[model samples]
Target chain A: MFEAVYQYRDQLLHGLGMTLAVAIASFVIGFLIAAVLAPLAVYGGPFLRRAIMGYVALIRGLPELLVIFLIFYGGTVFMTKIAGRYIEVNALTAGIASLSIVAAAYLTEILRGALLSVAHGQWEGALSLGFRRPRAFLMIILPQMMLRALPGLGNQWLVVLKESALVSVVGLEELMRKSVVGAGATHQPLAFYLTAAALYIMVTGVSTLLLKAYEARLIPHMR
Target chain B: MSLDLFLPAFLAVKNGFLLTVAITIASFALGQILALPLALGLTSTRQAIRVPVSTYTFLIRGSPLLVQLFIIYYGLGQIELVRNSFLWPVLRSPVYCAILAIGLNSAAYAAELLAGGIRQLPTGQWEAGRALGLHRTALLLKIILPQAYRSVLPAIGNELVLVMKGSTLASAVTVLEMTGAARVFVARSYAPFETFLIAGTIYLVMGAVFGRIFRFIEIKVAIPGR
Candidate 1:
């Protein structure tokens, strides 16, 4: 098992790179999607808002594992049909896409919750101050909502990082998959897995400390 | 594939939901039980128990449940000593192992949530309970638990949804739950999206329904819904 880790040092590094890339990409895209959907949720009539809410609920409720699988398998199938040729959906990309959708759904709620928490009077107050519709959002609302959302977003980011493990089944060579590979090659499942756990701990531990610091600095200012 | 395959997928998601519910309720129950003591330990008027429980909560809260599940289900199961120690039957089955894992996981989180609510309660309530001649259990059950549970229902509800989502980790260990079923479907037809899309729909619907039920229950207990 140690040999597996040794033999695949470069590969493991690559896996970490891919994992980080996937996490960042999915996070950005997911936030964008959620941003688009959030306004729809808030401003649209009951029917439109309900439609968006339904989408959000389903995405958030389902497991990332299932989402990854669906995207990998379904993306390929659907893409092939539309284009009249097969298109391979790489495990890493599929995992990112699927997770992004799931995260976006969760984030829509996060944003909505934050949005609601911002008193309605602020909007009218801004408008009275001659802040136009768009200017009001940028100056008056967005900052506060973002402050409220920071902690929740931090938690969700951690979740996304860990959920990337599910991408292994789709054949992504990330940390979890590398651990599996190492375990298989060396027949030291326990050792490799434990090492994998340590690596995860290092990543998460560092991030947790950072997020806590960020929260401490931000929470007081926001209030 | 044939229609028969769909049955298992549906059955699997249903069973998965059942397992999901079972895990959430059991985990919350156990978590609250364990965490309260631990929280008390944290604020203890003692140090020995306080330190270890704090450490336990920190470690558990810090790690991902996927790793924890793998450790409990696969790592522990692989050990001959564990098998021989008389927990074999339960440890061997993925379901039991999942419950143990999830319960522990929730315990770590719920203890903190409960503790937060407990801390937020008016100190006068405790004093009032003390004046009423209530001992530990009666004070907790009568005054503390109800208020904490009420105050934290929304937060706790969020945790419940999280636990339900977390149960998908069980699919990795060969449990044929909802995600597991969708996985099987994808493995068979290589149509991950359709299978997962359908599966996701089921879960979303389940979550919505669960949310409504919890809301109803919350209303019944608190402001009493009309």
Candidate 2:
């Protein structure tokens, strides 16, 4: 029953590594994009703000799987057109791109809320203290916003982690895809899938614990 | 780029759109029914009941719904007992399996939402219910649940959209929901952009319609003064 897991241990470990890499890479990239977009959405001109909002709305409205498929297939066509030859978008690139796109939309909303929660007085005080506007925003306001955004950011991280599993639909050979392959080859679907589930649970469980500890350390007074 | 495929793609996805809607509604209804009891268990005073229920939600919430769907659809069939059991017929169908998997996953999140709502209710409501001589079940059904659900109505609406998005995964197991339909059409026509865009539009419309309906309900059910 468990022999298949041992036999495919290397593949499973590689899959797990890929899953983490995709999740973390997408999340960091998404957060950086959101950091820029959220502020623009909140403070930019009406046209700029509306454009950002539209992008967010579009992503939010569509299913993640559809987004992944569109990026995977459409991107190949797009790049092919650009290069004047067929250019295939690999599953890994598509997975990370699509996930990052989806994550950016959600993170923008979270960060926007956090940004709004920071009072105007903070900005005014920073300027009065002789700090430039951009410097004040980067130094004083951004840190407070991030602290307030930590809880929502933590939840989004978990969501991104789970969503990475969907990338397997395009044959990315992530944890889910690897498990499918193992199950098929070993003819032991239950054992392989159960192991996959256990591995997911372990990562998520550890993440939840770490997030909680970090949140506690940063926001001790809230408790 | 393929303007010609747009109308044909729409026609192709019509049945798939209906199927997507059906699965979303059915699974969401099933989740709500399961949620009430799970929510009660979560809020139970007894550790025995609460611990098990919490664990169930924890495990379900921790993993991906795709894995859960595969477990039910593919993993269970591997069991000799499950294969021979009366439940095999229902479990074997990908549609039913998708519904069961998504419903179970939705129930975990809904239960947590309800539990959060329940915990947020002031103890004054419970005291008032007790003063009126309402029993435990009666007090819960009448006084507590109504208000708790009301407070969490927005979150509940959001969950509906999430479940609808989740229904797209049913395609993976060969259930031709909208996404699956789009995939098939694109494969045949080699028009991925047009087909997927049409499918995506349908999803966007469905989400907007549901959002409006929930917003209307929220306004209608508002407690007059506070």
Model 2 ranges off by over 4 Å? none
Highest-lDDT candidate:
2
DockQ value of candidate 1: 0.52
Error of 2 at B151 (Å): 0.7
Show the colliding residue pairs in model 1. Answer: A70-B192, A70-B193, A74-B193
Candidate achieving the largest TM-score: 2
Give the per-residue lDDT of model 2 (tens digit) for B1-226. 7777789988988869889998999999989999999999999999999999999999999999999999999999988899899999999999999999999999999999999999999999999999999999999999999999999999999899999999999999999999999998888887888889999999999999999999999999999898
Q: Which ten residues in a row have the lowest lDDT in candidate 2 chain B?
A: B1-10
DockQ metric for all predictions: 0.52, 0.89
